[model samples]
Target: MTYIVAYIASLIVFGALDAIWLTTMTSRIYRPVLGDILLSDLRIAPALAFYLLYPVGLVVFAAMPALRSGSAGTALAHGALFGLIAYATYDLTNYATLRSWTLQITLIDLAYGTAVAGLTALAAYQAARWVAG
Candidate 1:
């Protein structure tokens, strides 16, 4: 329960930071800041919001383990796997949505997934150690 809550809170913080970075730094060809919610014409289902929790949780979980093991090789491999899982979860869940239709969107999602995996893994591992010690 604590892990789940931690995942949710961490994800919200990370996601918002990501949004801010994207909005401020990225091109308009991508998304203008947090414009995804605004620009999408498709209707979002209530159940779909639940999908948010898994990707974030998986990334954090996988990353923490790999990083705590203190092997860069392990971190990279596991992080990539975590990223793939997160991407799959995201893509599969949004199949009905129009955002899932484009090549650019898919690539962008892949990048984000990989980043989340790598970053969360390292951060969670260090954080856990810090808290324990």
Candidate 2:
């Protein structure tokens, strides 16, 4: 039950933050470089899958451990590392395989991912603590 609460909290926090970032930040950053490669219409299925699935990774890797430790710092550090690795897996792979992918985009995304994951995990950890209390 606590795990479920933490998961939901993390998902909500991550989803909200990600939506804001995508709306306000990513387009300006990505569109100039990605141009036509940036789709005019977002494919809903993959986007939905990402939102649903990525939080599961966070819950397992960062939130659970942090909850066990009762330490927000643990959550932030582990979450950041997980984010870096996960985002790198995507951005680096695209940089390597895709003709249009840019090093700039990869680097920016890696940073963004790390920050977002760390903060989201921190939020989740704190929310769980509050809920538990």
lDDT accuracy of residue 98 in candidate 2:
88
Off by over 4 Å in 2: none
lDDT string for model 2 (35-125, tens) is 8878888999999999888888887899889989988899999899989999999999999998889898899899999999998888778
What's the lDDT for candidate 2?
0.88
TM-score of each: 0.56, 0.94
Off by over 4 Å in 1: 1-9, 21-27, 30-52, 67-77, 92-100
Query: What's model 2's lDDT at 13?
Result: 91
1-133 per-residue lDDT for model 1 (tens digits): 4344436544654566566755665555345533555445435574346347653555455645654575545545665677777686765566446652556666676777777666655554444444544
Q: State the displacement of the C-alpha of residue 29, model 2, in Å, after optimal TM-score superposition.
A: 1.1
Clash count for each candidate, listed in order shown:
2, 0
Weakest lDDT window of 10 consecutive positions for candidate 2 = 1-10
- Local distance difference test, per candidate? 0.56, 0.88
- Top-lDDT structure, candidate number: 2
